[model samples]
Target chain A: MGEFDLIQRFFLEGQGRLAAGDEVPVGIGDDCAVINPTPGMQWLVSSDMLVEGRHFLSTVAPERLGHKALAVNLSDLAACGATPRAFTLALSLPRADEAFLAGFARGLFALAQAHGIALVGGDTTAGPLNICITVMGEVPRGQALLRSGAQLGDDIYVSGTTLGDARLALELFRGTVRLAGDAFESVRRAMELPQPRVALGQALRGLASSAIDVSDGLCGDLGHILARSGVGARLEADALPRSATLAAQDLALQRLCTLSGGDDYELVFTAPAARRVEVAAAAALAATPVTRIGRIEAEPGLRLFDAQGQVLPLALSSFDHFKS
Target chain B: MGEFDLIQRFFLEGQGRLAAGDEVPVGIGDDCAVINPTPGMQWLVSSDMLVEGRHFLSTVAPERLGHKALAVNLSDLAACGATPRAFTLALSLPRADEAFLAGFARGLFALAQAHGIALVGGDTTAGPLNICITVMGEVPRGQALLRSGAQLGDDIYVSGTTLGDARLALELFRGTVRLAGDAFESVRRAMELPQPRVALGQALRGLASSAIDVSDGLCGDLGHILARSGVGARLEADALPRSATLAAQDLALQRLCTLSGGDDYELVFTAPAARRVEVAAAAALAATPVTRIGRIEAEPGLRLFDAQGQVLPLALSSFDHFKS
Candidate 1:
């Protein structure tokens, strides 16, 4: 298959599952996709790039790669409390393979269907495997949750655990760690297919003071919210949520992965302390658990505290694409 | 500089001219860009990918690469008769060089400022040179020019000239052809920095029944319009508008480049014979001259004719990433 046939057969031919009720007037086989926007709605757009060697391993499945490509972009929309509506995937492949395309289309459309996002338009090229996805969503004007909205004395909260087992999977792939059967599968799945917290983000609208998706480990991602909002945070180290599997690891490794692991794709937010019950109800409505781990302060720096209330030193860094 | 610093210094930090009256509420630093859409309008979205070796030669200037990358995508929007609004660039580079980034940013923003499109948000990473841009534009509801709107009796028209001189430049670079002095520079600029026929496309929205941008060669791209509109065309070979520089080339090379050369970035559209005056008026409004070179027919295949109306046999092929 050539690039045109590869895209047509895999993505646009019969996406019957994605086309129903879609607002797109012209799609796929056009110079541009025409999308009808809802009246009085603001649009949110974000693009993410995933390189083959840097973002994923060669041993990874094509289906997962497709899912992750779209998921990460959707996570950016989720961070802004936007509802995912449509996305474009610009894929560069070394060569065309029918089976790989089939699996990739399956995984990609599955996730798009789950989020009610239609595949709008994109380009196909031949090169080293690189996937760039741009996702578009809508929010009511002035209602978007931004990173600069964290207020002093607001309760800091996080959705899902502090760190998923994905970082552990990466460590295993790097030959820096080894795990048993079930543990290995769990971590690998987390790394390969991340679930963007779109619903939870929507639920936090008009309630959460500020929100950000934790793509880079908890500490660094939270630091973004702090820096943008010009506020400080005191995180309770002992209160950081962890999976039972991660709890089974050694103390140092557990802290290391939980504190600084990337690819978590979870939301960290802040809400007024008085709205604790409201926050809980919102999380319940989203069907995603939320944990209150700290509070935002007026000062412009972050501090970590153990159970004894002793301040801890900062030693780790976040994942920076160019710097790393 | 790192990726973040590179983007900050090169693109967003001082694009003050682009910020005035822009619809983007939260740009650059946020996870996603927030854009307010005008009421009663539809959005147009398109993405294009340019790889290092496949799309352009490494010897090409970084500034030209930046301009071409965004220009091609904007051309897609132009084909749909949408007003340029904003764009996101996912750029991958082998390393961060300040001078290269400075030149790229200058060329990119110069074109963007000319059209009032702002750079909203994007991601950058370390990898082989690959530039993926997703452009967003707006067209009033029900006014978008589409390829499916062409009628059987519509006259086929093209903006600017048929041959852009890009193919001749490519041939020169490949040692297949040689030009002297200014001719060489002119063709090289045509190849490296083809302008998007944005104003012409917008002017043709209500006048032209169907439209498309010529990127993959005049004949091949018009084939796209015909296929979608379920019609055929009878093209007059002698009527093709060619530049003086192209006419100076050998007849075979001139015909080949004008007929099947890629990267023209010109608009080919169709309108009713009765609307010929309106079409000319539209071109005047756009300040871009257009030539009538063909007519749509009820038949389902394209037929080319010379000055004496004798059918010409097809020989040349268009550029295809995978098959070629």
Candidate 2:
């Protein structure tokens, strides 16, 4: 099929289509999609590109790939405490595969419908498989959660209690580790289908001093918050969250996984110690668990400590596309 | 270099840096760039993806590729009569080569500077070469041009006289045709460096009823307007604009190239016959040449007329990514 026909058949029908509201006057099928921004709201935009063999495995299901593609972009909005609004997808495929497109669209639209966000515009071309999505969202003017907002003496927290399952799944696929059949399925699911913490992020808007999604591991991502906010941090290594599967591993493996493992899509945020009660209430409102793991400090660099306060040597690395 | 370092080194420093104004308060460093909307305007968004080999040959220079990438997307915004604002780029490259990136960024930023659009946020990764850009612009509320606004008896117009020089260059590259050195360079430039008629599109805003960018050949792109507006058209084949070199070619070759040539980022629009004088004034004000080559019809299908007013057969095919 041709490019336009492919879009019409796979994307334009049965998707999570918002009505012609004041926010969006036009959707797809125009030169440019028109959005009438709401008064007093600022727009939030982010883009992410996923390539075959680098971002996903050759054997990954098309539906899961589709979900992950949009999910990652949504995670960026979640980090900034923005509400999901609309997105554009630019896809390149080896050929026009009907079955693959259908399965992919089903998974993509399913999540879009759940979030009430619409796919407004896109482009399709013939090439190696690649999915690039640009998501646009909204936050109240001057109210977005920013990485530069962190202040000294703030308590650092992470949502969704446990992390590192996705990294463990990657290790399993690489044959560096092994797991039981049921356990393997669980970790694999964590790697393939991550749920963006949109609700928790929005709930923490007025509470959290700073926030960032843990896509590149806690240790590395927290460094971003520190670098941007110009505050150091003291992380309790023993207090870092980990899944049951990860905790079952050796002490060294567990520490490495929890500290440096990436692709969790969990939000790592900070709040003033005085607002602990408010933070807990916000997390409760969103129905997402939160764990306090660190504290912002006036020092110039990150320091890791155990429960007994002994310094732990830093030898961890985060995922860097080019370096890795 | 890592992905983040690559972006910082190439994109962040000295590239069309728009100040943190009321429109764009946050840019690249944040998880999601924030844009505060102008109260009286609405946003126009469009995305385009270019893959190596499919969109451009490997022999082409990186600078031209970068220029073409943004130029195509800007053309879409131009068709909607939107003023340029900001854009996000999602790029995947096989490796982070600093030299290639420097040249590409130079070309990209030069054009971006000319249009006064900032690169707000984006992503980079390791994979086959692919560039996807999402552009956001703005127009007065309810005043942007659209394909669905055309009416019967409207005069069809195209900005920039030449249409098929890009295709001529492609044919020359494939050894299907040949030209003198100077002539070849001119056509090749047309293929590599398409200038989007942004000014003309904005000028035609209230005068033109409908507009579209001629990227997928005049026949096919114009077909979009006809389909969306529920009107037909009669295009004067002999009156179609052509470069001096193209005009010297055989009649059949000229007809095929002009009607079916793609990659010409010119604006094709329709305005009422009564607006001809104003249309000319608009084009003159924008400093771009335009040609009136057709008229919208009440019939349900497009027709082509020769210089003698005889009906011409439809034997041309436009570019389709997959089918081609």
Candidate 3:
């Protein structure tokens, strides 16, 4: 069978059992899928690309790749406070390995079903392995959180911990650092299946002054909110949350990973200090833990206070794909 | 500079003026762009992918490549009879080539402006050259022309011409065929920059029963409509229109190129014979010529007739990316 036939048999045909709704009037097998959105609602759209070498190692499992691919795009929606309605995947593969496609689709669909997202349509081709997903979501009018909404007194909050173990797993994989036993496996799972905080995003729709997903790093992504809002932030190094595995490491290593390590896919947001109780309640409602690590300031620069209560110069930079 | 910096300098920074209405509440520089669609319209979404070696050569102009990348996705919208709204580009490049990026963005935006499509959001990464665009458009409720709407007595029509000189250009590039002077340039243009039939699609919304854009050959793409509509087609060779450059070639080469050559981006549609005059008027209104060359039948197979009205064997297959 040709590529088209393989896609039809595996991806398109399988969508028949995905529980259709009124959202998609015309589904797959067409030039375009028609989305019938609720009246007066706003639609949010985003696209994210993951290359084989740049995004993950060549030896990574197809299932993990599939999960990561969709998860990353969902993270974008999470930051914007949009509930995903549907997604389209544009995949390029070196070959059509049925085993790999089956595993990949399983992982992708598992996460998709959890979040109630439907696969509407996409195109598959043969090339250097690459995965690109464009996810569409819906937000009530005037309720979508944006990076430009942060104010001077807004408290900066991060959901589900910072300094993800994904970077630690990368370090160990690259032989730069090593961990033992369950710690290594935990970090690996953190790296491979970073959960997208969709529910927490929906909960923060009206509360969050500004928000961004921590893909690159907490410091870097927060910098985006600061720059866009024309405000700065002061983060307490001692207050930054880290996993037990990350906390066990030395202080310097912990700070390095928390400040510069990326691939966390956590939500870093800001809200008014007075709404602190509401923010806590919202996180509790979504069952995703959150912590206040910093606060917005009028100045246009990022400042970090070390554990010793001494202000330290923010000299660290986020990972740059082009520089590497 | 980093990937984010390059994106800021080229894409996000240039989206300041897009004649924004209430449609786009937020453009680039965000995790997701918020789009507020017209309250009564249905949104159409489609994505297309192009890999370096499979879709184009290293010698292709960067500007043309950009145009083609977006044009192909727009063609999907055109086939659905949707008006272009916004698009997101996921580009993977071997390196950060500023000159190439500028030309590519120029070509892409040039066409986007003509169709009034705004660049909403996207991501760039380091990898082998790959371009995937997800375009969103809108159609009125219940007004979308789908492939399943074709009836047995419908007349099959194709917009513009077919066989597209793109195949001729491909053969010339591979040194399999030789063309001189204007023929080479004409075919090269067809290959490099085939315009998306957006206007033609809008015009055929109510006039045509079913429609599909020819990306794979007419024979294969027509098969998709036949499969979806649960009908078959009989195409007359004498009635099929080929470009002047293609018509001058030998009958065998003409048949092969016209029958199987892909990347035409033309609209192949079917309408009831009673709407023939209205269909012709609609094509004229869009300033795109269309020709009737086939008839839909209740049978479950495609039949082709030669110039002398004898049955022609069906040996042509669409381009399959996997096998190629």
Give the TM-scores of the predictions, in the order they appear: 0.96, 0.96, 0.97
- Shift in Å, residue A319, candidate 2: 7.2
Candidate 3 scores an iRMS of: 0.6
In candidate 3, which residue pairs get closer than 3 Å at backbone N, Cα or C atoms, i.e. clash? none
- Model 1, first chain, TM-score of 0.94
The TM-score of predicted model 2 comes to 0.96
- The per-prediction CA RMSD against the true structure, in angstroms, equals 2.4, 2.2, 2.1
In model 3, the Cα lDDT at residue A178 comes to 82
- In the range A68-143, model 2's lDDT, one tens digit per residue, is 8889889999999999999998888887788788878877877887777888888888888899999999999898
Runs of candidate 3 exceeding 4 Å displacement: A16-20, A317-324, B1-4, B16-21, B316-324
Put down candidate 1 lDDT per residue, B186-278, tens digits, no spaces: 888889998899999898888889999988789888988899899999988667888778889887677678778878899999999999999
lDDT of 3 by residue, A26-118 (tens): 777789988898887899999998997678887778798889999999999999999999999888888888888988998998899889898
For candidate 2, write residues B1-324 as lDDT tens digits: 356565664665334245356668888877899998788899889999998866787877888888988999999999999999999888888887877787788778788889988888888888888999999999999988999988999999988877989888888887878899999999988988899999998998898999999887898889999998999999998898999999989887788788878888999999999999999999999999999999999997789889999998876534332133
What root-mean-square deviation over C-alphas does model 3 reach? Answer: 2.1
lDDT of 3: 0.85
CAPRI quality of model 1: high
Candidate 2 accuracy as lDDT? 0.85
Off by over 4 Å in 2: A1-4, A13-22, A317-324, B1-4, B13-19, B317-324
How well does candidate 1 reproduce the true complex, by DockQ?
A: 0.86
